[model samples]
Target: MTKPRTILVLGGARSGKSRHAQALAEAMTPEGCFIATAQAWDDEMRDRIARHQADRDERWTTVEAPLALADAIAEHSRSDRVLLVDCLTLWLTNMLLGEADLAAAGDALVAALEDAPCPVVLVSNEVGFGIVPDNALARRFRDAQGTLNQRLARVCDATDLVVAGLPLRLSGEK
Candidate 1:
């Protein structure tokens, strides 16, 4: 059986999205690299990062790309390596906080995934379902996140939504 070239997994926090993405990447191939986009800003974040790293075994190559996701994806993606980008929302947060160009970075990410030589799995949060935030920055983030998710989903070969630890195929078959 053939595997999907690109997949986008969307869910909330603790919704098993990253776990599911990691499993999918592991199943696709033995040589897998996890591209983490999170930055450890505090002790709690460092602990969280460590916990996520502990989940991986020896077969995983972990790369930390807190800002340059497109460059990391382009550099690591190859025929023998399956790429997994865990949590695009965090990358977006990083971009926003760093005052980077969100639109250009998002476009570059889309292009990188489109041209990847290996299969790619992207994980992101679905942050548009709840009540709107009262602050401007929060609202901007929600809007940008929704736009990015929709954009990535359009180009991906498959899209899934994890609800309560259950993955429901939103586009292609699992």
Candidate 2:
């Protein structure tokens, strides 16, 4: 089956969202770029990045776009290749911590997705499953994440929720 132009893959931590995105990209095309939105601010994070890098084979080109995700998508996206954006949640966090305007960034990202010539698969954590946080910052982050996810889902041609490596299509077709 032909993949949709825009796909939003949402899941909890370790719910295999990224893996599912990777599989989607690979299924679309053997040659594609994996746009990672993770910043290695610590040793553990650096190790995690390394492990993720090792997991994907050499057929993929990896690009790290922690802040300028829209620019990265615009630069690397094309009709002949698939673009896998792994985890928008980290990108959102990076934007929030960097004090960037969330609405502006998200708008730009949405524009980019709309204009993208290739299949764009985006991974993000579904933040509404957990209990309400006690801290204000945590709550703020949750709210921002929820808003971003909803906005992206609305723009995406298809939306999937991954749980324990199984994907349930929330919108569009399975």
Candidate 3:
């Protein structure tokens, strides 16, 4: 069986990366699964999550996998469906906070993507463009995010950098 396309969408905050990823996934298949990596830790975050949920219609199925992202991808992927992973940075944060092995988690995620039978659109923040963080923890997170983005970019069939709500193809076909 042929493996479907995998796209990596990278951008800064509010850069419309999620919207672009969603559009790409929806275009591939009407029946889609939204693998959300965000966890509502506060009222503001809950509101943000609600707004994201509001963007999708009845054709989408929502699954939260803030920590078990690789397992979610492996189990939810199907030959006739598309899977949109909205924000990998959040998943990384969850792993960091939960004291999980970052390298192992990343390896498992890459393996799951390689084994997926359907199209996958992954969203992530381009967090390395700003000034260096003032604290050690912040710096570590930033570095990890950059490394994760680089690794996923290499695995993805297409990588797009979104700026000011516009997408620029960084690799693969346009």
| Clashes by residue pair, model 2 | none
Candidate structures ordered by lDDT, highest first: 3, 1, 2
Tens-digit lDDT string for candidate 1 (1-174) = 455789999999899998888888888888899999988899988998898889986888989999999999989987887899988999999999899988998899999998889999999999998899999999999999999999999999999999888899999866
Q: Write the per-residue lDDT of candidate 2 for residues 16-46, one digit (tens) a residue.
A: 8888888887888778999999999999889
Q: Per-prediction count of colliding residue pairs?
A: 0, 0, 0
What would the per-residue lDDT of candidate 3 be over residues 7-114, giving only the tens digit for each residue?
A: 999999999988888888888888999999999999998998999999997889999999999999999989899999988999999999898989898899999999
lDDT of each: 0.91, 0.89, 0.91
For candidate 3, list the clashing residue pairs, or say none. Answer: none
Worst 10 residues of 2 by lDDT: 1-10
- Candidate 2 runs further than 4 Å off: none
Candidate 1 clashes between residue pairs 3 or more apart in a chain or in different chains: none
- Each candidate structure's TM-score, on Cα atoms with residue i matched to residue i, is 0.96, 0.95, 0.96
* Deviation (Å) of 5 in candidate 2: 1.6
Worst 10 residues of 3 by lDDT: 1-10
Candidate 2 displacement at residue 38 in angstroms:
0.6
